[model samples]
Target: MGEPVNREKPLRVGIIGCGKIVAQYLESFRRLQDVQLTAVADIDMERANAVAAEWNDGGAGEGGVRAVGVEELLAAPDVDLVLNLTIPAAHAEVALAAIAAGKAVYGEKPLAATTAEARRVLDAAREAGVVVGCAPDTVLGTGIQTARKAIDDGLIGAPVAATATMVTPGHERWHPNPDFYYLPGGGPLLDMGPYYVTALVTLLGPVVSVIGAASHTRAERVIGSGPREGERIPVEIDTHVTGVLVHESGVLSTLVMSFDAVATHSSNIEVHGPQGTLAVPDPNHFDGETRLFRLGGSEWETLPVSAGYVGSGRGYGIADLASTPEGQEPRAGGLLAFHALDVMESLLDSAHSGKSVAVTSRAERPSAVPLTSQEG
Candidate 1:
């Protein structure tokens, strides 16, 4: 691995995978000065070329984003960090390759398809002395962070429990290539659970055990968008998953994720304590209203934005990584991602075994981010 990122300079970034998600990150990267987009690569040369041509560095003088081969980009001298936007199944493989190349890595969520693979990524980064960061940086935004501030300020009193619900028809409705979504690495639980579970951990604490039940609503889904519209794809993963996470602190978080449901009026997340109930906004988004309802109150009150990166988005986690002091983990560090993955994976295992499964891994609630801005 390489030395610590120099805080005085922008962390030069090379991106891998030019999927739909890459656009969001590119938009965020343009607004973040802490990290520079240096290069891009994808299995599809057209995608690599398209993204490389799409990014306008505006003369930051880092030579602009170049379309290079995966091996070339990984071995590039100007690249300090690899921003992995690969599919969930290839997450660990790319992270390991970046670590092997001695470049620090920050990747999209789950860390890997399974905990076993995730541990290897973490272990390799550790042995190589490089940093490993992962996504759902949405929690580092005002919505969840303001909720965190409220809890930390004791406004919620002794945190008792939380409920996180995400209901969607399915990604095939919109995603151009949604096949992988039904495969091993994708599912409502693994696909959308990271945001909710990570938020639960952020609000309550680390989960010690989980009890879950899952079901498959259908074996095939007809595509509703793009050239593949109306095409049917096999569903190899659970479509709906409901679980109870027993936090180490005794806070129980109930999780409901589904691709089968039409809609729900429930808050994305709600934390209940003796004093009040907090209406946390969507964890999948960067900002929204974080409301609170006191024990004696009849109506929910919108709380002020008291924490998190202002105007943050997908790539902000990498910027956060660049700003982190050496020897300290970024808020979106690998540990949290791994813990979230373990909890989700355990829930599925429990779903299969028809018994509660104890989560062996734990991640500390990352340090709270004060109301801050990446625009600065």
Candidate 2:
């Protein structure tokens, strides 16, 4: 592998899709000396103007990125990287456009609506020869890294099984536009399953087989928190999904995701081996501490939070990269996304066919690829 890239030249970034999340991206982008927040674009003109004003007034940088349409942002010469923070459905279109415009892309989770769309984007990026990165890059954070180190050092003898869960009360209760969550592309499996599945794939090898079951908890959900409050929303997608992932390394993984369940404990992902158990932190958030539970040990030992992907809420790692010298790379990239999508597809198919679905898509870890620009 080549040596990590130095953050000598600032990466000029243009953000597409101005929304509440833009604040987090803008906040983080302003802190990074190696990154210049160059521009902003959104379908909503009012939202674009508001975000542009905020960025220019110092929410992002002294002179913030220009608020423009998608085409203008893509055409902007100063934008070296395009941030695809658009809603999940629009991710592929914006990312494909950015790649076509010969700019690198950094996108939010799920990569795309389907495995086919994700593959198309991947092919386009390869054809364009520009970098394309995905979010929840928390796999490169201290929690996962420390656990990986311990496993490498034989702290956990050999991973045997894993159980991951991401359960919540659904998004229609919060997000203003919740219609997308019920569409064919939207579901708990495709929405929140990325983080749990990606983290598992990062730790374990590729999956070999999958059997899944899925169902809808409620036929309709009421909008709880927005202008559409008290409005009934029909649930067109599965609200609950469960799957069993068999890995190439002989490890088994049980995954459960739901939008209607009230989970008391945090979303826990545990890997069990002969020697010990490693409880990885939630990969959805950028930074946090993890714990290791040795077989003979009395308690779960706390792992230090050394990495600096620290920000409030979702953009901690992005913010840390924007502010610090740490040049971040996509830990949860296309491969992980593809694998998760494949797993979800298998689960849905298995549920429908009443049979175990074999997962054919397999990815070998790239020996020449480094997870991040920051190396120890």
Candidate No. with top lDDT: 1
Predicted model with the maximum TM-score: 1
* lDDT values, one for every candidate: 0.91, 0.73
**Candidate 2: where are CA atoms >4 Å away?**
1-8, 59-62, 306-330, 364-376
- For every candidate, C-alpha RMSD to the true structure in Å: 1.2, 4.4
lDDT of 2 by residue, 178-284 (tens): 87787777888878887777777777878888888888877888888878888987888899998799889989999998997977474378889998888877777
Each model's TM-score?
Answer: 0.98, 0.87
- Kindly give the stretch of ten consecutive residues in candidate 1 with the minimal lDDT sum: 56-65
The total number of steric clashes, by the backbone 3 Å criterion, in model 2 comes to 5
Count residue pairs with overlapping backbones in model 1: 0
Candidate 1 local Cα displacement, residue 348, angstroms: 0.3
